[model samples]
Target: MLFERLRTLPLRLLFSGSVALFPVSTWADTAAKVAPDIDLKEVAPVPRPEAKAPATADQEPSPDADEANPVPGEPEAEPAPEFVKTTRFSLLGSDVLPGTSTRLAWTPGIQIAGLSQPTPVLVVNGLHAGPTLCLTGAVHGDELNGIEIIRRTLYDLDPEKLSGRVVGIPIVNLPGFQEASRYLPDRRDLNRHFPGNPDGSLAERIAYSLFENIIRHCDMLVDIHTGSLKRTNLPQLRADMTNPEVAQFTRGFDRMAVVHSTGSDGMLRVAATRAGITTVTLEAGESHRIQEHQIEAGVNSLTSLMEKQDMISRMFEWGDPEPVYYESSWIRANHGGILFSEVDLGARVNKGEILGYVADPITNAQFPIHASADGRIIGMAVDQVVMAGFAAYHIGTEAEVPGE
Candidate 1:
């Protein structure tokens, strides 16, 4: 019975692990935007360092022996290149050298019309040794903002100066992306099949392939996403704040709202966290369209993360920190009709304040939708027709929600 209940839940509800189902609607015309092609221009070839000349044995030794041996007050000699701890990062059977970048592809066993498709991976291995940070986007194919965010972030990075490595998968669902659909050709949601089985369904095999090959190598993870169809979300980070490590990860994204959500089953964040990897999900804008503001914010947040990790030297001033919301609730529409929103995203609201109204077009009657609790609007439905019981406004409240 539990399995049945979970199986019947809508894909949007899967984010919050809510069992209730609502009518799922999307803008069909907005789905055809192609995933942006990676620009090779950003990755320039690194010039080799000049080799130092070795002293000849015939040369006379220095007159001052104290000059050769460092005194107590003198600075110590730097470690030789060979002595430096340099790690050769290997992924998908390819070895990526320090101060360079490479692309790795993963192909599942299943083929569409007998043609196998490969997922593109971008890896930048820095010269200095440090942690491995993984950046993934477009887990749900229709979510395009994350795809752009990953691309922009990767483009701005320089492996020659970076202390750690950054691995990026710009588009995780090629088939769904190609079809402009949220699910695979089999109509299965790929986000719900993490750490998947090799012998299970097609989505499971694909998930297993990703987990074993790519995800397992990460020390830290930031999975980017956007709101579901017909819904728009404010830029925020969702993480399990109870865990010290998770809380630290949340703090890395400067000046961004942090929402505490101990992600649901089969989610990449949850699975990665179980594997002892610090993980967080970045939700911004909405699906099917690329919003420039959201994309820029996502890029800046990632830059902030790298700065926090001491992976790079560039310091970004992110003004004033945002609060971490522990409790949140969705205000459902009480009447079905054409909806108009009075409040904007991220607007503060008090208890019983009117957020929007549902109007009967035929009768010209309007029903005011009031907030159940005092909070800020973290997410809301775009101005459109809505049905009764539809989640219209997602408010981040001051009260802590149970089990969160």
Candidate 2:
């Protein structure tokens, strides 16, 4: 009985530091017998495989899962929205926001004895996006008609309804305007120096400043002027029609005569055109004093041009279209004396027609000045004086005229 009890003991318990003196079947029987009332099934170890915890319904998937498991035929995610940008218009360090107007005084670096002169600038920025038009007057300071024209034009503009911006410089040559002369204090023609050199002469420096700071901002330009040196021009446009853009600009002035001429070197129009800006010159009455009729005509023409460009919503009424003359000549005086003109501007004359005559008060002699071609009188000399070879009349010939 003692040997049977010893053999019935568990071999695992005996091997875990206690010596086993029984077989395997005997050890199983002994373990069953030892734990009979202690429940032997509870003491046995359980076997299981490794697994992850189940996710709750409210939990989100990992980033790797989102990238790996894309929905079928679904587009990629969109980027975040960006901030909106607004348009701002500025000139000569002065900002003119949309639907607003401002005046800027531009002073170039060129000075006389430590004194700088400011050129008057008027800017009107529109509420909508569109082209920029630049209007310049009094390039020759003595040309007062353009100054008045610009003033009247600016006075009538409403920035709130305008489609684009308009920049007006009523007086470009301040020194000449103050002195009532057509040139600067140094006697240089300011209009002749354009796209000027920064390190060049005084006139050139001024031109550079104006061109770089003011004109370079324009997509289109209109340079207003009047006849120079005691001469009067009928309302007309002078432009180089070789450029289609310039030709279109000339057409904007409905009833004004257009004279085709490539402007001289260093001229503002020429320089601006070379830099890809479409430009035209509007010539009106004579210089030194303002002519009411010329000023009125200039104002109307500019208004009509703005209308054509869609800068303004108002529709301007224009008269019958004028002729476009490709060729014109000046009728010069043959005798030196006091002069009188029998014909007025815009008068049509036949070949050899007597438009004016020169009278010599000393010798009581008179000479008739006749038109050499059948054309309209576009420009004439002032009635004050006459000299041999003086340009007395300008005839706008129909020869070589281009089709409208």
Candidate 3:
């Protein structure tokens, strides 16, 4: 019902309640070559920031600031992320020299009886160094939106014109992606393991390998994901605002909604954040199928983030920023049955308003599901049969919303 997206832990992952893209050709050749970049139209574009004030005569631009609180009239801009061109970069035993791209394979720590299929990792090492940015998708095997997102984002970069490196692992869990299932063959949820143990469970080993070898290579990370368990989300960022660095990292995306969660234990975001790598979980659209708008929004957002970090320069037009939800909860179903949502994702609701209803298919008895508090619907169950106590509507509030 939510993102962290463990099918078994919806309620605990919820804030205070019970439960909570790809193309073909340059669009479909995923396994063999670097994906072809598609033309993406920005959902809401933000023009490039105006030039920053010059440094004083004796001073140079400083890149490390707790928060470069932009001065009112003549504010100094936040230093763009820096990369050392003198350093060499390598991945999975291969040297990726500057101005070049490589398609490499990463075999997980999992060892099966016969042969294990290797996962593909794409890398673009830029000519002018900046930072290594990692884009991971399909941690949940059934979620297809992220895989497509990684493809579009990675292939779009030109090594010669790029500043930093971009590494994309479209399918982190190949077994789940191959079977189109959310859980691994061992019935374990891969999302629950992070910075894994070499001598631990299979899921743990895989997590450890990725975290150690792949994830550690990045300056910042974006773990792309979508809604789970027949639910969907408006394009948004699931980030822990308590961490100063993590909080500031949320500002790069163009007007994407931010949901504050210190994040559940063992999630890649929490582990990576703990590892001192600024990371955020991006939740977009639903699982199982490809959604066009979601992919475009993801591509645009990633592009904007790179530009903000001075990794790329794409002047995307952006809208007024969206508010960050400090608190959120899942409004669960009191009666299990065929649930019909009366409201849509991002719909504003008043306290006690009927967001949807559950109707018994047999007796035709119906019960309306009302909001426990005034808020906006950020995620909800699709028109499907759900059981009592099932997380049906996810309401996010920035301070009691509009209604009392």
Candidate 4:
């Protein structure tokens, strides 16, 4: 009987497992007969494959997913747009000639330095499409090296071979240049006014307009100057070589005598540099007069710069240039008197050499001025009488020389 019940029990239990319960009277009798040796702890529920859990707020993102599909609470990355290349936008248009280059000019404008006086800037264009470069001269009216330089450079160039545009303002400060004075008609130093106010003083208006219009339009600039009033200088290029691009472009000026001048604030070079232009300042000859050697050197440097920039295809044969690179200092007069120079401009002098003698005109007493250090006499006073603290000359010394 028991064996027969056991065989049928599983069949009944399989279908009735959810609700199956024995009656109390029968379950008690069955429990008495059943063995107590079976272990419930030995049996474990079988583990089916776990279903995937829903994504949570703190879930990490997958590596392959696009950044746009960022996980919740993730910060998105935003990048700035890339820079676009510029095209030829010259004020002056060029005539396209077969197998030749293009020539251009700046849009002429009147700079109101005073109520009655006006200044003009002449811009030149090139045949090819490249960066705009500005060549400014006669900021100090007496410095004529750059004025003649621009003339020769323009007449000599052909447009068909040019790769970049050149903007030449032969006389930036026309009033000063015309009057042969270093300052404007207002007696204000034009170099000192920078980023000028358009509605401000006479010097300021010109400075403001120049900064806003032409300077803002160019990518590079070259400013030419001579020594202060009576002084002179060997043909040299002054620039900050710290910038990589400036160094690259300027290095092509083979005969350029490089000077590492600590540029003054608000000066033309400083203003141009601050405006992101690589600026080159050339100091050549004495004020009011142009030397042939200086002019030759200026032409060689200008051509070399233009050629290196691929502004023109014609390569110039420049003789070897000895670049005396230096940081410079000036020697000033200690006392006011009639002056007699022992050494002339461009001459090399040793320490203690009698540079000049200052004599009291009324007393007829002489004071001998000696060279403080060994250096080249880069500049000197043209006028014999000088007041104390007046800058007589600028000396280029050994220490002034650049190491690299």
Taking all chains together, the TM-score of candidate 3 against the true structure is 0.77
Cα lDDT of model 1 by residue, 164-280, tens digit:
899999998888889888888788988899989978998898888788778998999999988886899999998998888998778789768988899898898998899998999
- Which 10-residue span in candidate 2 carries the lowest summed lDDT? 32-41
Q: Write the per-residue lDDT of candidate 4 for residues 1-404, one digit (tens) a residue.
A: 85576466553232221223333343233221111111112332231221223336799533211111112232322111111012223232222111222222232123321233323333344445666777888888888888888767755655335566666778878778878898988999988988787567888877876776568778888888887767677777777766656656667686766766658877999888887888878888888887788888887888888777767767478667554545467778888898888777778888888888888999898877887778777667775688888787667764333345
**Model 2 segments more than 4 A misplaced:** 1-85, 112-114, 399-404
For all predicted structures, in order, the TM-scores are 0.78, 0.77, 0.77, 0.68
lDDT, residue 341, model 3 = 86
Residue 96 displacement (Å), model 4? 10
Minimal lDDT window, size 10, model 1: 63-72
lDDT of each: 0.76, 0.75, 0.75, 0.62
Total clashes in model 2, counting residue pairs 3 or more apart in sequence or in different chains: 1
Look at candidate 3 and tell me the lDDT of residue 16: 15
TM-score of 4: 0.68
Clashing pairs in 2: 8-30
Query: Which parts of model 3 have CA positions greater than 4 angstroms off?
Result: 1-85, 399-404
